[model samples]
Target: MKTLKEQFDILSDGAVDLLPQEDFIRKLERSIATGTPLRAKLGLDPSRPDIHIGHAVVLNKLRQFQDLGHTVVLIIGDFTAMIGDPTGKSKTRPALTLDETRENGKTYVEQAAKILDMSRTEVVYNSQWLDSMSFREVITLSAKYTVAQLLERDDFTKRYRSGEPISVHEFLYPLSQAYDSVAVRSDVELGGTDQKFNLLVGREIMKAYGQEPQCILTMPILEGTDGVEKMSKSLDNYIALTDSAKDMFGKTMSIPDSLIARYYRYACFAGGEDVARMESELAAGTLHPRTAKVQVSGSLVDRYHGEGAGKEALDEFERVFVKKDIPDVIEETVLDGTSLDIVTILTTTSMAQSKSEARRLIQQGGVSIDGTKITDPAALIDLQAPVILRVGKLRFLRISGR
Candidate 1:
């Protein structure tokens, strides 16, 4: 049988770069040998309801640990969510109400279970402990780290340098996250590369608490569908786990061809051999980027929604996008003899945002009318029949004529 660490390496496809792999492996071997499964912690502030594929990257890694007979402690930062984590934010996030946090937390578990094993995992809310602590106790905990040390964080440092408002509460966010490790006595913790500084603080706190320092594993950030920035819902660049099969497949297909290999390695469970084969095919010119993208999208949709839906979505993509065929479903808006211009129809149906913008897009070959590209600013519409309006690659709107 392979060692636990070896199993993890295989499952993660060697994408994770542990700070000290050998030390962690030795510790893991000893923990397993002694029949004591290591405690692993992953924290998520439920500030947002939508969980994207980027979040799944970490959850999938946690699942691997759980499968290896280790304890997986999921920390829901209900308290922190209210304060708003200052991880990647330039400006401090606006505070969320307690009721809002509670309501969002309830639905988050359902989405989280799509990636994490809720039955085997130990689900915890940080508010349970943080809320009960006294002010002096909080101060005592706060003293563990210095202002200088806290300011070292990139976001804080940048804000301080650039004269941006760095809220005082922001300093306490990582301190609270660090205290979570101490509270759970976590043996190992996982986060994205952007979270390395926060994860490292957990080790310091764990040591201060007289427990063995937790091993930190940071995974690479999954690029958003834009194929650039980290996957984020606010950026409108995410493929939500809850997104329908058709939407998921379409969004995945929309990603730039350059992102396919990276997505395969991190987002999906494609192994070394599978990835190598795909890369070889791309290198040898046997596979086109679109075909490869379709495969990638199909596999992802199948993983989330099921095989049948994946195939349907794939077919839908081919018909609607590749072949420029009409979609199965199109919105029908009744025209009630009220005079409506083409620009108004386009903007109202969300085919375009404004008349000026619509005209610009049309001139750029980015707008189409009934599957035909339209470039005239003064294009008139007779609302006596149904016509489809398309914008760029993904948006479609149907306007019915009176």
Candidate 2:
């Protein structure tokens, strides 16, 4: 077992806040003294089917706890997901069906296994307990927290003050999530900084249930490739765990140089010393940003796509991007006609979803044929020979006449 200081240092590496640090230290001390592993809890609401590297920030911390001889309780919030977590939301999110949440939860667990040791990790669905609670029992649980206390949440407060409709059931999300910690008897709970209110409520609710309050650790939200907004699929800035190795590497390379160190620490889960060295070297002009980015991107690809995949991705990336050459394995689309409009070719090849989008891509000079930008949406191309149709920076398709 690692010493308390070692455990603390490892677990708190990229954490934003370790509330009641003394309590956390005490818990670690007690666990080490007694030779008992601490149960660290992380509740994931499978509101989305895809997991991104941004979500990996907290998971990486959980993995550190696991590596240090601790138990990790992974709670899949199938029940609370139906209510939708309102953190950082300006409007009420539409509720998902139980089936949808369950399906998404399965995907969540599968992807989470990329980081967590699934066999050792205790995976539980909140619905196992929350779904069994009676109306009277729910009322008892609801009585533990006041509506005013719930209103104190930033999202709730904003909605309340703004005269926006706040659903009564939305208040149950935190209480339900809090009950998860009590059910698992977690020693510590982890969440994003936006979830600080919900995590703290877990401590209060656990105490109310006559159990030791779990310490809360909050992780910083990882910014997307744009480096301005939080990483999210809705913003089209997130790199999904399921993204292809090539896409993942390419996307990681596209991030601003400013985010290189942050992505190394949070996304790649690089050690503090290594990340600091890279940062210092970059600042001193001893290291090229592209070289550092390739390392970071390659590490991510290797992690999710298995060994040697990063190297393969790097080779392919260099061939396509650095050498100004198309991928060796581009998907070919055969058309019956000799000539086709740029918009039709784009949409027909599934490169663009709609004609308007194809036109937009053409107007924005994001569409190219054989290294020539196609600015006119109405331009016709003769498909006499196979031509590489490039869209944006990553997508490529070969068009040829049948």
Candidate 3:
């Protein structure tokens, strides 16, 4: 068993907040001395079926707990998914049907397996306990927290002040989530910084339920490929867990040079000492940013997909980006050649995720057609022959139409 201090040092890396840090240390000490693993809870609502590298930041922290011989209770919030978490939403979230919730929940676990150890992980559905609760039981649970306390949530307060119609059922979302901790008897709860409000509620609710309050740990939000907004599937800036090795490598390489070190800390699992050295080299200008990015991109792909995939991806990236050579295997999407806007063409070729993004790249001179930079996004071209399309420094496509 690692000493409490040693475990704390490892667990604290990349974490944004660990509420009442002393409690976490004490829990670690108890777990170590008793040789009893702590139960770490992480709840997920299945509203979003796909998970991205950004989601991995918290999963990685959970894995760290598992490495220390702790039990990870992965609670699929099938019951809660119906209500949808109202956190950070200016308006009410659309409710999910039970069938849609179940289907999404199924994919959630499958994708989470890429990061979580399914064998050791205790996969559970909150529906098991939450579904069985009587109305009286729910009311009793609701009675524990006052409306004034519920209003403490920033998003709730913001929406209320803004006069956005806050739904009454939304209040149940946090209460139900807190009930999950009580059901599982969680010793530690982990989540993204966005989840701090919900996690802290778990602690208070646990204490109210006559259980030891779970220590809360929250990780920083990982920035997406844009290197601007938080990584999100909705933002189309996410690198999905199910992405192909080639796609993963390519997307990771697209991140701005400034985000390479941040990705190292949040996205990649490179050893701490090694990450330190790379950051140092980049900081001192000893290592070229491009070279460091290739390493980061390849390492990330290899970690998720396979060992050698990274090197293969690196070689392919060099051939395409550095040598300005077209890849042997370009995804060929055929379309009718009657007429096509260049912006639409860019999206169809997967060069850009949206028309707006395509236009941005075109206006910035980052897009070219037939080896000529296409400054006008509205340029309509007939794809009679195979046309070469290049976006930014990386993506290349061969578009063909009848």
Q: How many Å off is the CA of 279 in candidate 3?
A: 3.4
Per-residue lDDT for 1-402 in model 2, tens only?
Answer: 677788888888888899889999999999999999999999999999999998999998898888888999999999999999988887889999989999999999999999999877999999999999999999999999999999899899999899999888888889999999999999999999999999999999999999999999999899999999999988889999999999999999999999999999889888989999999999999999999999999998998899999999999999988898888898888988889888988888889889998898888889999999998888999999989999998998888986
RMSD of 1: 3.7
Predicted structure with the largest lDDT when compared to the true one: 2
lDDT of 1: 0.82
Candidate 1 per-residue C-alpha lDDT over 233-322 given as tens digits, one digit per residue, 9 for 90 to 100: 877799999987878899998888888877877778677788888888988899998888888888888888875777999888888878
Q: Give lDDT per model, in order.
A: 0.82, 0.92, 0.88
Give the per-residue lDDT of model 3 (tens digit) for 126-208. 99999999999999999988899999999999999999998889999999999999999999899999999999999889988
Runs in model 1 with CA error above 4 Å?
A: 1-5, 329-402
> What would you estimate as the lDDT of candidate 3?
0.88
- Stretch of 10 with least lDDT, candidate 1: 8-17
List CA RMSD, all candidates.
3.7, 2.5, 3.3
- Between candidates 1 and 3, the one scoring higher on TM-score is 3
